[model samples]
Target chain A: MSRSTRIMMSVIYWAFVVYVFVPLILMIMMGFKDSKFIGFPIKSWTFDWYLAVFSDTEVLTVFGYSTAIALLSTVVSLFVGTWIAVLLADRKFFGRAVMFGLMVLPALVPGIISAIAFRIYARVLGIEPGMFAIIWSHAVHNVPFVCLVVMARLSTLPKSQREAAQDLGADPLVTFVRITLPYLRPALIGASVFCMLLSFDDFVRSFFLGGYQPTLPVLIFAKLRSGMSPEINAISTVVLILTAFLGIWAERSMRRMKKET
Target chain B: MTSDAPTQGAAAGTAAAAGPRSLWSSLARSQPYQKFVDVLFASQRRSFLILLLPPIIWVLSQHLGPIVQMVSVSFTDAYPRPPGQEAKFTFDNYLLFFREPVYMMPFMRTLIYAVVLTFTTLIIVYPVAYFLARHVKRENRMALLLLLLIPFWVGEIVRTFAIMILLGNTGAVNLILKSLGLIDRPIPFMYTGFSVSVGIIYLTALYMLMPLYSALEKIPASYTEAAADLGAGAWTRFRRVTLPLTYEGIGSGATLVFLISTGYYGTPVLLGGPNTTVFAETIAGFFHVAGDKWPTGAAFACIMFLASLALTGAFLSGMNRLSKGGRK
Candidate 1:
């Protein structure tokens, strides 16, 4: 890079950094404003909105619901996803391409269409819509992603490892527990984190699944619907920080895996 | 056309060698030291099926079903019927949409909006993505990438509404400008196409950055280094080497942005003025608010679904084609 080009890139980069941070800074500033609607440009600061945001049961529960659903979806999807990867790796199966396509289907579909299908599907099954169904939908949506990432790891595993384990008197169960699971730890964790973040950050799937209860993103969407308010800003501030931390965690894990390979 | 298929022959070979016991029994076995090998192989197939069935079923119904239904809806009169007519399927909806000024104009508007948003986001995200990919040190690289993507992790509604606050008439933007005597009254920033585009850009720009950044990062340092060693200019190397290498990322990013922006609702609804009706909002209006005419909304949705499917296919095949990374 030449000095002039380097200077130009640096200037543009800093400007972009400003573009990224300023809205958020304004959001935080607006959060402390003594106002109900997000009017922007603070006259004076107050923590009343923050208090209202935390103290309001309805607002707080949405956050709680999203967190719970995200966690459960992550764990359940990880298990199912891992199982699929194991099967995919160890077996040659009929209609594998079809299965892989089906697995990634939900993501490829538009949200509005998916929402209607869920609405109908839940009705025909006579299953009530709520947290359980919401979690199920999220898990189903994310598992294929988990499978794809983990399958990358699974394919690279030397056949010798499994064969060696079996020859040394280790049963399939023992070999999987002792060798496969440990070896797959990084990809598994990567898949898990990615799935969790996805579940939490999602809006569309949750909208369909949410009936009596609203997930965090849906709740935020609802709030955005009527009008913009300062309370939403405070909420975004917290989310931005948490997700940033999670992204860092993912980046490190990926780098570590790359080095090992 | 799709992913690599699993072959049954592989299963047969593994099964013949692994031996057999019940997969469930392997789980319940007291001694996990090495004994339960046969059972693990026995249930692996079934467990994998069980694992994938729920989500696939969900997608088929939730995804594929709606698309089919939506296309069907596009044909019906939906709510207002012709004299002596019943709720029947016809090409009228498509014809009406194309012919009627009200619906036809908005569709064009929506298309322009999508195209503009795509190019604008691409232009804006490129340098930031570039810096993260090539210029940032490895140790600091991850941190910078996180910095770019962190806004997205917060969730779209929150981020969109945050912009609403900042750009609101009495919002911080005006407040700051006023405090600094840069303006006399709050600017009419909210509920306009500008505000809507800004919000959409913020929400979807992250999609562009991450993929482009991933592509950029994958370019070996040696390519540029060797170019520099040969006295090639920075711009020359970037145009010749870096850009070509990241075509997959570019394709994916553009596809993602295009798909996401087309289906967009939140930003446009919150920030778009009365004249700012998007195709998505029209779909929402057709079903939810427009007399419960599920069919018409379904039709509009089907168009979107079809467009996205085509776009996604184009993107993937393009990625596959460019997978050689311009080496050839």
Candidate 2:
């Protein structure tokens, strides 16, 4: 590469990084700011907001709901997604293409529309909107994502291993458990983690379907819309860190899976 | 889990060999377990259905059924659901949607914003995606890409709030400008059209990057090398080979970004001023203040959904033709 070209590339690279990270850094910084107001200039540093987040019952309750729903949906999505993905990867059947499209449709469409559709369904069915409604709605949106991730990983596995196991007098289920399952372990774990993060971060579906008590994102949206608070920044910083940690963990596992295969 | 299977099998085999009358041998020869295994792998259809039924049923009940219900509600005279009145079928909701400039304007604006945001994000992320896909060292590329994408996983609400703080009256941007004497007063960045647009771009720009990178990365280097050997310059090689090869990806990325951005509710509501109303916010508004106007909201959602589908179909087909031409 020419000197000018190399220089230009480096500039663009750093600029992109800064553009993405600056706001995140700023958000974290503001959480530590003692003042209620948000801005660039830092005054006295304090951990009051973080402390307040721990004691805030409303935030804690909403967070508890978010965790419970995310966990429920992620576990549900993992099994369903793995089963669907295994079928998609291992089998050749009629209407496979159409089934694949239908399976992926929920992810392809916008979440707001899903929220609208589910809300309407709730109304028509006279189902009271709450945790039950929100968990299932989140599942609808997240199962496709889990399926897609696991399918990608499944596609990478060698087909010969299962055949070899079966030729060795192993039953089909034994072949799968002995050969395919280990290969898919990383993908399954990664998919579950991804689904967990997705469910935790989801706001659109939860916003509409959550009845009296809302999830964390919904509560945060309400708080942000009504007004700004240092407390929100503190909570958001914590959420951001948690998500980043899980994301990196998922990324590492996916990388290790790739390397292993 | 499978890693333990071999060792366990070997151990069981040794135990059975060492003691023919052992419990392990008996269990291995158990008739009920044998039958259960045979039944479990009985038929592919049975297994597929058993495995798939849970998710399929959940998706059908939660997603497809509701979508059908929502579409049906859009066409019914369900608005102003009086205390004792039943809804009848009518074309009035669709008519009002098309005829009213009030509803029509936001619909059009939403499309226009989607297009502009799609292109804007494409232009900004394309080079970065290309650099990551092609220029970065192979060993480090995945880590770097993950680093870039981690911010996106931070969630939309948090990202928007970050922008709100960055562009607020007393935000970092204004504070910096004021400190440098660039402006005596803070710019009205928050609650403005510019802020909403920028926020939407910030929230979704990475989505475009991932697809574009995957698409660009899939283009064989050999194709570019062949073009280069044919006396093509760098720019010519890129234009004739790289760009054409990735047109499908570009279209997919643009479509993804457009669809996601256009349906944005929180970003516009939080960052946009009163003047800036998107279709999503409008739909939410109808539901918020007036419980009886659900049909109107449902109609708006149906229109948005159809419009989005139409746009994606057109874009995909157009790109298919373009990519085919490039191939030839």
Candidate 3:
């Protein structure tokens, strides 16, 4: 590459990076501003808003509620997704193509469309809008990701391992528990964290289905509607720190596990 | 089967003589339980069914079932009909969309915005993806990509709030411009089409970047080097070789960005003015009102869904044809 072209590319790359981080940095900065308003030229700073996030009962409850829902949905999706992946991993199967399409259809549908559909379906089933309804929608939404991830991991498994287990008189269930499950540990952990983050960050579904209590994103939406506040920024900063940490951890561990195997 | 019956009878007799130590333990050790376990794994077909049944039921009931229900609701006269009323079928719900310019305009605007924004995101993100995948050292690429992705991990509402902070009257943009003497007064950037577009591009750019980066990364260095040896200019080399090779990535990235942009409810609501209302807000407006209008919302949602799917299908096929032609 020419020197001028290389310089141009580097400049563009750094500009994009600045564009990505400027808003985020401003958000974090606004969180520490002492005044009620959100703006530049902060004459004072304080930690009161960040402290308020922990001391406020309502915010704390919403955090616990969102975490509970994320955990429940993640566990359910992992179970269903792993089952489907195992079934589809066979070399030749009838209707495999059709089944795979069906598996992926949910993830392709837009969030609003699916959320509306689930709202209607929940009413039809006499399931009132509440925690159960939210969990059901989140798990269904997350299953495809889990299935895809687990299936990718399963594809790399050596066939002879299973055959060897069978040669030693292990039953199908035993062999699966001892051999297949162990092999899928890294993928399962990765998919679980991904699902948790997805479910926790989900807004449309939770907003549509939630009743009296709101999840974290829905609560943030409510706060936004009232108007922007330093408290909202503090809450956002905390969430950003948390999810970034979890995501980085998952990526590093998955890469390390892949190398080990 | 016949032999198992006698064994089961003996086990029951033995349990009776054991003074009822524990009914659960006795039953677990019984012949019938063993037989059931044996039958489950007796054939590969049986095991396959055991694995396949749950996902099939789940997909049918949870995934496809709700969508099918939505379609049915869209055709109905009313939903949540008062206690005992039957659901009468009608096309009026869908007809409402075609007749009202208020509804139709936003729907059209949504399609246009989605296409334009998807293209814009592709243009803005392509060079950066190229830089990372082709120019940067492979060892540093992953760390840089992760840094870029951290902002996306936060929820939509939080990120939208960030945009609101950046564009408000007293926001960073206005403050900086004022300080620099570029303007004496703050510019109103919030609640505009520009704001909404910027927010959507910010949110959906990652979708485009991932696919394009992977596609660019997969291109062999030899092809570009060979083109260089043949004395092709930089622009010609890119147009003929790199762009054609990344068509699959472009197609996928465009599809994801388009679909996501079309379905956005929160960002548009937060950043857009009344004039810039998108189709998702229009559909959501119906659900926010009386229950009687929910059918109308379902119908509108279905229209958006089918239209987006059709456009993407066409775009993908066009990309496929172009890629094939380029190869020839």
> Candidate 3 residues A178-214, lDDT tens each?
7999999999999999899999999999989999899
Q: Score candidate 2 by lDDT.
A: 0.83
Pitting candidate 1 against candidate 2, the one with the higher TM-score is 2
Worst 10 residues of 1 chain B by lDDT: B33-42
Q: Model 1 in CAPRI terms: which quality?
A: acceptable
- Model 3 residue runs over 4 Å out of place are A257-261, B1-36
Worst 10 residues of 2 chain A by lDDT: A1-10
List model 1 lDDT by residue over A1-261, tens digit each. 767777677677778877777777777777788866566445688887778778889888787888899899999889877876776665666766766676666665555566655544554456577887788777867877888888888877888998898798665556787778888999988888788888887876677667768887787788777666777777766676777688668757966786777
Candidate 1 ranges with C-alpha deviation above 4 Å: A88-95, A124-129, A170-174, A227-229, B1-96, B176-183, B225-232, B290-292, B311-328
> For residues B80-159, could you state the per-residue lDDT of candidate 1 as single tens digits?
34468676767755555666678765566776787789889989988888877777788888667666656666666667
TM-score of each: 0.81, 0.92, 0.93
Task: Give the better candidate number (2 or 3) by TM-score.
Answer: 3
Candidate 3 local lDDT, B147-244, one digit each (tens): 88888787888888889888999999999999999999899899998899999999999999999999999999999889999998888889999999
Encode model 2's per-residue lDDT on B124-226: one tens digit a residue. 8988898888888889898788878788888888988888888888889999999999999889998877898889888888889988898988977788889
